[model samples]
Structure formats: C-alpha cells, structure tokens
Target: MARLKIADNLDGEPQTAEELAVKTHTNAPLLFRLLRALAGLGLVRADEEKRFHLTPLGRTMRTKGDGAFGDFMEMFLGDQFLPWTKYVDAIRTGKTQFDQLYGVPYYEHLKKNPDERGRFVNGLKQMTKIFNANITDYYDFTPFKHIVDIAGSDGTFLINILKNVPHARGTVFDEEPSIEAAKKNVLDYPNVKDRLDFVAGSFFTDPIPAGGDCYTMKSALDFEDELAIQILKNIRNKMKSGTKFLVIQTVVPDTDEFHIGKLFDQYLFMLTGGKERTKAEAEHVLRGTGFELNRIIPTTYPLWDILEATAV
Candidate 1:
C-alpha cells in the first residue's frame, strides 16, 4: 500500500527497487525484499530490467482506479493501527482499546487534530462514492422529497441521491471541517450543489436539521447503546413523527455464520464502545430512540445493509 502511494501510480512508470526505496525513504535491500514478497503474491511483477510494475491487483490500491479500496486500506491501517494491535485485550475485556491506547476518545482525538480528521473524513468520502453508486442504482428515492445524512461528510451520498430525485433537496449534518471539505471536494457538481445544505455540529449534542422525509446514517451509529440512542432521540425530536430513517450498517447476523461482519464487529470492539448488533439488538436500540423497524433492506453487498425504520 505504501509502495502504491510512493509510486503514485498516476505516474504510470515502472520503478526500480532502488528508485522505489528512495521515493519511499526506505532501505533499498529491505524494500526489495518487501517488493519481492508482493511479487510472489502476484500484486506486482518485476521485469528482467529490474523495474517493478503494478499488476491489476496492485492497481486496486491506486487512487486512479474506479475502486476506493486504497482509501479503505489507508483509513484502517493508517488511523486504526494501534488499537487493532490491542484487539486481543479488548476482546478479553469488552472495553474500548482506542481510548486506552490514545489516552483520549477517538472522536475527541479527531476534533483536536484537524489534519488527521481531514484524512479520515476524506477516506470515508472516497468509499462513499462507491456506496452511493450501489444505493442510487438499487434503491428507490423517487418518493422522497428531502434527505438528511447524519455526519455525512462532503454530502457525497446526499448529492448522489438528490441527483436522482431531481427535485429533492438535502442536508449534510456533520463537523465543520467535513462541511468545508465537502464544499471543496464533493458539492461542486452542478446538479446538487445548490440544493445541498450543511449543518455543522456534533450529532451527540445537536438536533438534526428538520423537514427531511428521510435520514441516512452510514456507519454513523456505531456507538454504544446510550449514545447511539441519544443521537436517534435527538434526530427524532427534530423529525416529523412519520419521517423515514435509514441505517446503512454492518448489522450482524445472529447465526454462528462465517461472515465478515464478525471480523468487523471485533475491529469495532477494539476501536469503540460498540459492537455490530443483531436484528433483535437493532430493533431494541431503535425502539428506545423513537423509531420502529420498517424493514431490513438488503443490498448486493454482504457487509452492509439498509435498516429502514420510521420515526415514532
């Protein structure tokens, strides 16, 4: 991953191990060994000329491609590395390891460091591009006149949804930095820029913007029960009684199924005071927060599901 970033695949040139080591500021011999392993894995190949070229699999980690797996890789390994190393301890204790490792809450740490917050938010933005594509293609938004995305950075999801709805306007309720980033990176598209509004505040404290027929939370509800319910209750206070609510999340299955969400739940265990909830747990959480489960909308993706609900 570091090599992909160092090579900056946009350059479209094969690099010698020496050149790559220099570019990435690593020892040439060490870099060659790493590259050789990657070669063995077939993510890259070396020519007789001793120049390494990215393979199709390697290109998946380049930002130039249609895939956002690069950002996903960076976001996880870059930002969440330390806490993940302590996952074993977290699993044994059922406590947050992020706060323990960092000496502050993850969100609090973010608020104090704008650069990291920007990187993390942009990572999510990159991933959002693909998520929004699948959602707009498969879901129906024709009947909804307005949409609000909680903690939606750059309004990417809302912008895509509004593009489809045409007449719909949307709100992005997120951090101030995220609002700025969205303005610069996401809302420039002519279709939805004028129709989108950004409300800057922490969802843990603020009331969500009102008058939306739908509220979307994409990985935003991965908080402990009380805090998650507080956000829902806050949204409920501002929303009309019958407003639709959507949680696009890793809703864990109750079975001893060998699903990836189980791994994700474990990762969440390391980073948060939350775990991926089962359907019954989801229903319980939502019910306490002024919402009722309408349906669980399955998408083509296995790790994510759209849990539809109605504001009570």
Candidate 2:
C-alpha cells in the first residue's frame, strides 16, 4: 500500500476498488482483493455497495500525518527487510549479512545510495518521534546548560530535548550526511533554532566539541566493544571531568522476561555488526572508557532508557 501510495489516497469517504485503482494506478480486480484483505485486518471496511472507507487504524498508514507509521512500515518492511534473507549465513559466520550482500556496512550503504538514504533517515525521524516522545519527562535536563549529542542523526532527538530544556543550548555531532539532514530538520523548530548547532565529523577520528556540561548518545554505541570504547574514549578525552554522559538506548534485560531489545539486538547486528548490551555489559564498556555508570533511568517506553554516567 505504501509503495503504491494507496494508503495515502484513502480518505474516510467510501470509494470503490475501481476508484482507488484509478488513483493508485493498479488493476481494479487486484486492488479489490487487497482492499478486502485490508478490511479483514480492520484497516478499512466495505459497505454493501463494495465501497471501502479507511478505518482509524488504516489512516495511520498515510504518508503525511501526526501519528503516521507509513515510513516506519516502508523502511522496516521494505529496505531493511531484505537483509533477513541472509540471517542464517550471518549467524554461521558471525557477520552482518547486509555487509556481505551489499559489500558495505549499512551506514556505508546509505552513503552510496541516495534514495535509500533519504528514506532511511526519514524513517528514523518518524521512529524517533514515536519512541523518544517521553524522554524529556523521564530525565531532568534543566540542570545542564549545554548538551552535545554525539552521532545524533538529523538532530531530532536533540531538538526534542532542547524544546523541553529552555535554558539549555545543544550541538549535534555527526557526519556530513546527518549534519546536512539536521540543518533542514532544525528549521522546523523555530523556538530552538538559535540554540542548536550541527558539527559534521566522526567521533572516532575528529575532535569532539568541548565545553558542553552534558553529552548524549542515543543508540550510537551499539557497535562492538572495541569500537564503542574508541568513540566513548574520544568523548571522554574531549569533555571535562564530572560532565554528564547520557547513553539513551535499550539495555537488554538480564532476566528472560520479554523485551523488544532482545529481538532488536539481532537487527543491530545485521546492520552494524553490533548488539544490544545488558546492564553489566554496558557498564563494562563504560568503565573501560573512563566513565562511571551511575544508574539507569527508565522512560515510559519499555525499549528506551537513560544510562546516566559521569566522566571520571
């Protein structure tokens, strides 16, 4: 539906499959079958006249909306979905199948393919909007005056944080692709426009911007311990002692009580040869990189949390 733009064409008003087929440019017979399937899933309902209307649930598939999941569905089930075919091979070789198939890491793949990159970044923005909505409420940011979001993509999370922290300014540290995207994203938030800055560089090679009392990395340290430690140490060397370091990502539960991170860990491995860590695993990496893990602050969202730390 997303690929054909069928969902976006649907309004609450009833329309027959032939009408939808005209808009979406698909065969009327095939469209009717799909519409019937959608109705089975409660995304739409057909009347006696065989005209279908989008249910509230179906409207979430629209490309443009406040709570739309169209991009999320498109990316996860579209671009990212292809890598799953290599899952068994990946497990056998302990490698990212995406890298094997595409001849580069997922991030590198994004750099090579502009169209896919655009979709991936937009999908991430949409996903962040959904998951990181309550992060500011869960963690206090008023005390920190300046925050530097390391490897912050498009600055969506930083912008969300700065919107809540009126007194705090922030800088988003990322590569050129993300910095370019962040430049455009920052324009949407006029209130925090003056306070946010985007710095383009790699945390592994470039000198991190100094003087921020707080630094944050949301889902940025999912790489192997050595690589994650290198990035963390780079930040540690640049920032002063006692500066707060917030690692805002999921820590796999020690117990077997189900959590999304358990499954997402495999996805991370597929994309970057990285895996989600348990609390102990996270602390081991942090401690090795000259930071002390203070506590894990839970957000309302199950998969998100703040791993509060201090540069020692």
Candidate 3:
C-alpha cells in the first residue's frame, strides 16, 4: 500500500504492476497480486488497460513533495520492518526483538546510524505536521509567557505555535543534533529568535531549562514510563506551583473498534518498546509524578488528546 501510494504520487498516475514492481524493487507477479487485492478492497481501481489508479482512500496516502508519505514509509518499511520476523519470540520473551535483531536498542540504533536517524527525524516532522495544527487549535496558549518544548525535535511544533502567539516566547530542548536543526529553523523569525533558545543535553541528566511558564511534551511519555515520569518530576520540581504541563499524545480509546491509537500502540510496542496510554492511565502517571490531571481535551481531528496537568 505504501509503495503503491508513493509511486502513484511520483508518476502522477496509476501505474501498471510492471511499473510498480520496478519502482518498488519487488517482483512483478507479487506486485500484481498485491494490487489486485487492493483493488478488491476498494483502495485502488484497475482500468480496462490493466493500469491501476488510486481510489479516494489511496489518494489520502499520497503526499506532496518530500512529505510524510515518503518519510513514514522509510521509517516503517526500511528500518522497522525487519524486526517483525521476531514478533513471536518477542511475545514469548516479553522483550523487544528489535534489540536482538539490531544488536542494540531502538534509540541506540537511531543514534548510531545517521541515515536511520535522518529518516526517523523526518518522519517525526511529518507526524508533527499532521498534529501541530490540532494542538494549536485545541489548547489555549494565551496564559503562557514562555513555553518550553521538552524533547522537541526540529522545533517545528514550537515554530507553529510561536508564529500564532506573538507574545509567547519559545524554547526547544533536545539532543545536540536536533537542537542544531532547531537553531537553523528559528533563523527566519528574529522576534521569536531572541525569545527562542535551543538547549542541548539529556533532560534526565540536566536541569530542565528555567524561565518558561508552560512546558510541553508531545507524544513523549510513551517513549519510556520511568523516563517520562522523571521528566515530569523534574519539571515539577522547578515549576513555581502554577506552571501548566501539556502532554500532547494519542489518548487510547477504551473500545476495540479499529482506531489509529490501537494501531499506533502496536507500532510503538513492536518497534520502540513503548505503549500508548488511555486517559485514566495518563491521569495515573501524572498523579504519580506529583501532578494532577486538569482535563483531557479532545480535538476535532482523530487520534490526538491534550492532557493538561499542573504541579501539586
């Protein structure tokens, strides 16, 4: 599905199986079978000439320029796809097979491989593009003087927020490589540039940067439970008792009807050894870390929930 979607965008038309196979570097026969299956599912349609075209669903996967589609495909298909062979073993051992397959943990693998790191970062940016607007809409930023985005990669989300809230200053804290990218991104906005500071260090080891009235962590808690708590605790320790902490992440719905959260939970579990939490689960985590859940703000869009909490 991903390959066909990308190829359809690249070629600007529905391509035949031969064209798809050559573009995707797969066998033509297998490509034909896959396309046929997709057509049957109404994802794509085949013309009388046997050329395939994207259905409405298929067009949703198409991307413009160097967009989410390519980055998302690279992250899932190229890097994370290999570890699925060991899923049965992972289930048996109750451990991630990614470590066994790559001989390192997921984050470690990303740190060591620049190409993979680039792809992962780009994919994250793509994801942020989808969610940043929702975040800007559903949350209130008027009360904040300065906002610190913890674990903020490339500052894309912060940039969007800062662009809208003129009086609100921004700070982005992340690893050195990501901070460097954020610096480049902030160059255009001189007004926000003076207000924006890019700090490089592990949030676990370093003091959370001060001077921000509000702090945010986007989809960051799911990365590691202990680390996430520690970050919240660290932020709580520095806050003046009124600082607001916003956690923007997918709030897993309790029901089992197919939703993006369900799929993302499995993806996190399989690839990153992380798990998405429900609203109650989030409340538990926040309360355990010396904060109280203010509310779980649902967006007009899907798969995103804003958990607003404050230090006790």
lDDT of 3 by residue, 190-284 (tens): 76787788888777668788878889988756866876787777777767777888888888879877778877887787787888898888888
Q: Give all TM-scores, in the order shown.
A: 0.93, 0.93, 0.85
lDDT of each residue in 113-229, candidate 2, tens digit only: 888887887776777787666677788899999999998988888998899998899999999989988899899999999999889999887999999999999875688777898
Q: Where does model 1 exceed 4 Å of error?
A: 3-7
Which runs of model 2 end up more than 4 angstroms from their true locations? Answer: none
| Clash count, candidate 1 | 0
Where does candidate 1 clash, by residue pair? none
* Order by lDDT, highest first: 2, 1, 3
| Model 1 per-residue lDDT tens digits across residues 97-172 | 9999888888898888776676676566666667787787767888888899898887777778887888888889
Query: What TM-score does structure 2 among the candidates reach?
Result: 0.93
Local error of candidate 3 at 188, Å? 4.9
